[model samples]
Target chain A: MEKKYVIGIDLGGTKISGALATVEGDIISQYTVPTKASEGELPVLGRIIETIEKVLEEGKAVVEEVKSIGIGSPGPLDTKTGVIITTPNLPFKNFKLVQPIVEKFGIPTYLDNDANAAAIGEYVFGAGKGTENMVFITVSTGIGGGAIINGKAFRGSTSNALEVGHMTLEQDGPICGCGNHGCAEALASGTAIGKRAKEAVTQGLKTSLANYENPGSYEVFQEAAKGDDVAKEILDKALTYLGICVGNVITSFDPEMVIIGGGVSQGGAVVFDKVKEVVKERCFETLAENCKIVPAGLGTDAGVKGAVALAILESK
Target chain B: MEKKYVIGIDLGGTKISGALATVEGDIISQYTVPTKASEGELPVLGRIIETIEKVLEEGKAVVEEVKSIGIGSPGPLDTKTGVIITTPNLPFKNFKLVQPIVEKFGIPTYLDNDANAAAIGEYVFGAGKGTENMVFITVSTGIGGGAIINGKAFRGSTSNALEVGHMTLEQDGPICGCGNHGCAEALASGTAIGKRAKEAVTQGLKTSLANYENPGSYEVFQEAAKGDDVAKEILDKALTYLGICVGNVITSFDPEMVIIGGGVSQGGAVVFDKVKEVVKERCFETLAENCKIVPAGLGTDAGVKGAVALAILESK
Candidate 1:
């Protein structure tokens, strides 16, 4: 069999990362560019195209050698038509993402929400490898996630399922960015943690967290790890809410494993241990018994790897 | 195509319903018998076999004419091994259900937790017909559910993913049968409604619901519709929980439609309207915009129909 290559791209609000990989998923070359998305779609698209061209150039591979291009973009996208419906971070709506790339390279292009790509990436090469069903959740600026079932990305009716982060954890609780009350993202995400810490300071309940102006989730975790009571209280509460979200996902999806990734999970044992404890206590015993809760193995590479997986699988 | 017939059985604590259906899902004959579960597994199994025999006899079909046998029993069962792990409402543990039925008739047999069967049933022939993905939720004695994705029952990694009823809705809320705190079942199930109403009456609340000796969810709904404030409050709260569950399911699964089943949904528009309202308000606009919230189409026959769906699909 002749060796085949594919181009994988991860499109984010701040940066675009592109890579050339073998059909077996080995990255031969990669390139990155700042998105500067506020400059508008054309410039961002130019950067994305430049990154892809640079990866190919660095790999010394011709376009003819590449099987296809796959992109994982911040989305609520239409993978079927390869149209980006809307992205919170990028200024694109109903953007014909695939057609433009396909036209440029005369190759098939596939598109999926970044979260879904991460899930497929993990399922194909990371923590959930060899599993028939799994959920990949990323707790970053805001919680986001995707599901892989029966060894494929489980896109629902509109090619978008696995919006795990938006699941309502508490009724009539805090309002979320998506306008829902008490969604998992609103209660347990990095943004939520930072907001809670800020609120504590605003309420005049001073602690070590107050030292960092406009403290983010990382600062809060740092203070908590040092045994700061106020910071510890906030972290514990946020982790507890995250635990409830994990429990709910387990009960609903019953995946073989759940892979936790993102900036928040970088807290390591502090996050996974607390969340796993809640899941063990809350999920159905049978499900809990079979579920392996683990951290994502691919890390930053999840985006490009996932895009590659999507390209390979969908192309087949 | 040659005409093919299959047998489907819905085994419950109180009754066992069996039906003979063509491969195309036309039910030709059906039978039912008392489970008398307290009489033990052997007696319950005997009743189940009797119902299957009666259905076959009524249809004038020979064992050779039946393609397979499918049973949907109260679950937490191993679909791969055809074993009933343990049912909260039934006295069956590690029972080799499929092997026994297969031996009795020398026909292939498939067994699924009842909720999964109902999901397939709805997907194949009822409310979710023609959809690629759907969720079937039975809000009955206790809330339970299943999913049909890409035209197949979505048995999670352990063949038990769609435990929608056990999802955590509120932190530190009521305990569920599954021993979880603030689960959807604990907050919205018929049993929960009755328990809440009984508690209200016990608390010396003045309401017409007090006229009933043991008011179940039905009596509470009736009184609430007739202007009982206490009953109205209880009903509204329960519906809110149900709506939240529905909303959460929508976001995570992104199914084309959600088919609401169970005894509680028998209240019809009164229940559906309120729940749909909540789902519309809670789900991400992209998801909620396309989701169709409707009542279960098969009504009481969901079990047998779902079992038939399981039989036909699995046999293929």
Candidate 2:
């Protein structure tokens, strides 16, 4: 029997990434193209298509060898219909994402929320590997994640599951990008970290962070490591809120593992250790001991590899 | 195929409720016996067995026709091994619950957390019927819950998933029964409502609630509806926190339906309507519309029915 392959695409506002992988998920080749999203949907789609074509050519693979193509996008998308409902950064509304890809390559195509794809990546090959239930959370610019339930991405009735970061933490807390008050994303994400740091500076809290015009989450982490009290307080508060979200996920989904990814988690043990400490303290004792909180194993490859996992798993 | 039957037992702190139900979840007969749990493990176990036998006898059923027995108990129990792992109210520690039933009947036995069984009962035959994923939460004297994913109970690796009430809503909030601060149970449960009301009366707040020696959650709800400011404030706060938890569950699990049961919810449309209003205001825009927050349909039978659900669903 001949080996089968699939194409996985990670569509983002900044870049379009594509990979050709075997059925077992070994990447054979990869390619990427800048997504000038400001140029709008047509150009972004062109870049996505070009990126896939380049990956297929470089891999020396034909459409017949590929079972299907999968795309993971930042979205509140309709995965069953492969339609992009409305994304925060992308210039699209009710855009037919799967039909175009299927028509272009003559292979079946599937689409899912990028976080869900990343979760599949972790579940199949990363930290969540071998766990029947796992939650993959990325504490990046904004907290975002997806859950793998019973060894599959748990899409709800509308294909939207694991919208974790928007859960309310403080009823009267700060407003979130989603126009809600006290969402986990609004109170604990990297964006929230930066916002809090800026607020401290604006409040004239004598902190070393004020040296920069505007500090990102990385700078805040660095300053906190340097023992800057205000920065330390801000980082601690953010991680504490994040820890509450993790605890909520623990009680809510009760996954076997929770894999932390995204840029903010790249702060490594500093953030993971603190968040785990809080979760262990706050979560129910019966469930907390059985759950392992770990960092994502796939790093930058999660999106592409997760897309591949989605293709391989959902194709059937 | 011959008609099959099963036995479901709800082992609560004060009573053991048993039901004889058909394979399709139709209850044929029910029996209840006082637990007198302080009588130690052997007596309680005897009570559980007697209750099941009584249920079968009253239904005019024979043990030969019974496929299996399922029990739902207040836990920290090992559902996998069918061991009671030292519940808060029960004197038993490391007690074998499933083996005794199996030994007595020469039939298979399944044991699960009471909340988990109730969730299955709701998903299979109650308000959550016809939905692939549902969350059942009971906000009574204490808050507790279970989740059903893909039409089955989502027991975690240790058979302890969906500890919804224990998730922290406030880091520095009141201490919960689980020894954590600001758990949803600590902040929003019926106990919490009563505590807040009593505290208000102690603080000498002028309100109609002070007429009662100790106002409970039911009284608070009653006075709130009657336009008592203090009672209204206390109930509204508890319900608001409950709404936040509901919203969190929506974003975390993205279930098709959220079924609220327990005495507090039995306040009928008054509490459910307020809680739904808060959930709609707090949940993610994409998911809020898709999830229906409704009252549990099984009512008092949820526990026994859920136990029945566990017996039938897990036996296969």
Candidate 3:
């Protein structure tokens, strides 16, 4: 008997990723297309469709066995209604993508927040496979998260649950895009790191980072690794905020494990080691001892694969 | 057929509340004793035992009918191993209450932090009934919290989850007992409210609160309600901190609902109305629209009843 497959799409500001995968979550074929978001939602969505078509054409056998399609995108979204209310990175407002995809494919389609999909992906195929309850945090330009309870994504009463980055780590600290003061994202996100590095340079602190006319957080991390004091200070502050955020998650969710992903996490052991140390030092010993913080295994493919997982689960 | 019963003991610094309840959570009889914790653990344990016996006797239930006993106390505690590691309010360290209770009744006994028990109680019988995921927060002298997921108390990896008060709301705002700066508890707890009020008076802020040589949070609330400017200022500041804390919970946990309990909450609609307004204003609009902030329904009985709920679940 031929096994069934699902199509997963991850829509981002600059690119659209599409994949054909088995019902078991194994990727069979994948494709990508540039998303000219400046050209607006219609053009970018057309590119998404083009990418999906390309993936399906390449995975003809899997496409013939395909049951459904799923899409993961940045949110404020209405997962139940399958509408993207307003994604910060995308030039779309209340875009109804699910019905359009379902109409195009003549099969069921599901939509979820990117973070939520990534969490489901991790739970189904990554570090959280064995845990009954877990939380997945993605620390990129902005931090975001999703929770899984009893092996299912926990989307609160609405699909807007798990805004992990917006939680206040300091009340009177830096301002976040969300208009909050001292949010974890405001203190520890890649943007925050970059901003801090720039401030240090502007404040006349001597640093090798002065070499970059406009340095980003990755550059700061690289400089810190090379023993630059200003870069180290920025990295330490980010790590402290990250640790506090992790500790707060432990105190609030009581999940068996926490899986972390995202761009800044690409710093690898440096980020993980410091995060673990701070979480342990700050949270209650019992919680600190029991909760393991692990890096996400699926890497960049997590979102698309998670979308595929959602398709399979919803179809079943 | 005769139904089995359980004994639930809520041990606090000032009072010991014990109840004999059916496995379905119906209270047959209850008793209270002075904890007099300053007198030490042994004496307190004797009082707890006496209260349990009195409750059972009053209910006309024999020891054989009781399936198990559950104790809810302040922590740090070892719920997995059933030991009270240390309770700031109850002069106890490494106290093994579960073994003694099990030995006396010849039935298994369970121990949990009071906040955890209260959360379970709310989940099973009070505000959070029928919800698979929720957070219960008690705003008393200090804030405390418990998380419930999939119909069970979420004890984290080590059974010390839900330390909501310790999460940082302000990084450099105030000193906390946990040696942290600007913890939610340090910024918004009842203690914080009183401390801030006293500080205002010491700083020569003109107010009717000066009528009391030493004013507690309740007195401040009373004064604020009666139109005292200084009291209003202090109350507003406390509410701002609390609102931020509430927003933090929404951002962090994304639960369907949050139940607020404890003495400060008993200030009636004033506290709830203000907290709700500020939390909605401050949190992510999507999250704020989805989550409900409700007052705790079980009132003061939440702790003991929560213990009963835990015992019944464990016994089953």
DockQ of each: 0.85, 0.72, 0.54
TM-score of 2: 0.96
Residue-wise lDDT of candidate 2 within A1-316, one digit each (tens)?
A: 2539988999988888899999888999999888787887777878888888888899998878889888999888998888999988888888887887788878889899989999888888788888988899888888888888777788877776777888888888899988889899998888999999899999999999999999878889999999999999999888989888888888777778999899888888888889889888887776778789999999667889989988987885
Write one digit per residue (lDDT tens) for candidate 3, span A55-144. 878887534467888898989888888889987778899888887777786767889999999998888888888887799999988999
Per-residue lDDT of model 3, residues B178-258, tens digit only: 877778888888899899888888888898888889988999899999999889888888877887888888777677889
Instruction: Tell me the alpha-carbon RMSD of every candidate.
Output: 1.8, 1.9, 3.8
Decoy 3 TM-score against native = 0.85
Give the alpha-carbon lDDT of every model: 0.87, 0.86, 0.84
DockQ of 1: 0.85
Q: Comparing to the true complex, what docking class would candidate 2 get? A: medium
TM-scores of all candidate predictions against the true structure: 0.96, 0.96, 0.85
Query: Which candidate order results from sorting by TM-score in descending order?
Result: 1, 2, 3
> Any runs in candidate 2 off by more than 4 Å, and if so which?
A1-3, A38-43, B1-3
The pairs that clash in candidate 1 are none
**lDDT tens per residue, model 2, B1-316:** 2438999999999889999999888899999999899889899889888988898899999898998888999888888799999888888899998897788888789988888888888887888889888899998988888888887778777776778888788778899988889889988899999999899999999999899998999899889889999999888888889988888888877888899989899888878888889888887666788889899888667789989989898877
lDDT of 3 at B76: 86
